[model samples]
Each structure stands twice: as C-alpha cells, then as structure tokens.
Target: MQSNHDGKKPGLPEIVEILAVSVCFTYISGGEAVGAVGLLIAYATLRWGRS
Candidate 1:
C-alpha cells in the first residue's frame, strides 16, 4: 500500500495552487510589475530545481 507521506514533492496542481495564492497576494499588496516578477522568479526557481 502507498503511504500518504511518502516524502514526495508537491505535484503540478498543488504547485499551481500555491502560485495562484502567491501571485494574488503579491499583486494586491504590491502591483502588477511586482506580481509579474514574482511569478517569473517562481517559475525560474522551479525549473532550476527540477534540473
């Protein structure tokens, strides 16, 4: 049987959920440019980590 906490990283849906929240908060608190930069940075970090 598979365990719930098998030490696996979050899947795409989970990552997207997090990204959505982060972007929303940043956009509301900061602005469009800041939100865009934050998204770019997040995407870069995820890609870098995957490689």
Candidate 2:
C-alpha cells in the first residue's frame, strides 16, 4: 500500500482497491483452507512418523 503510493497518503479509492485485490486473492487461493491442510499434513506425519 505504501509502496503503491508515490510517497503520498492513499485516499478512499486506493484503500478500496487494495482491499478488493486482497479479498480476491484470498478467495482464489482458498485462504485458510491451505493452512488447515498444512496443519493436518504435519499432524499426520508426526503421529505416523515411525515409517
């Protein structure tokens, strides 16, 4: 955001654009789902780590 601006404070439009982009990115990437999957994989590995 700060870098997006040319050293000037961003107004409402800039803020909205940034938020919209972030929301879209999170949605497209499945956001917290990836984190949950990673945690599950880690737990399974640790629990069945004898292999």
lDDT for every model? 0.63, 0.54
Please, what are the lDDT tens digits per residue for candidate 1 over residues 7-26? 46767865786678677766
- Per-residue lDDT of candidate 2, residues 1-51 (tens digit): 134534455567756755565555557657865655555455434533423
Off by over 4 Å in 1: 1-6, 32-51
TM agreement with the true structure for every prediction: 0.42, 0.46
TM-score computed on alpha carbons, candidate 1: 0.42
* The candidate that achieves the highest lDDT relative to the unseen native structure: 1
RMSD of each: 6.3, 14.5
- Which candidate leads the pack in TM-score? 2
Candidate 2 TM-score to native? 0.46
* Model 2 stretches with alpha carbons more than 4 Å out: 1-6, 33-51
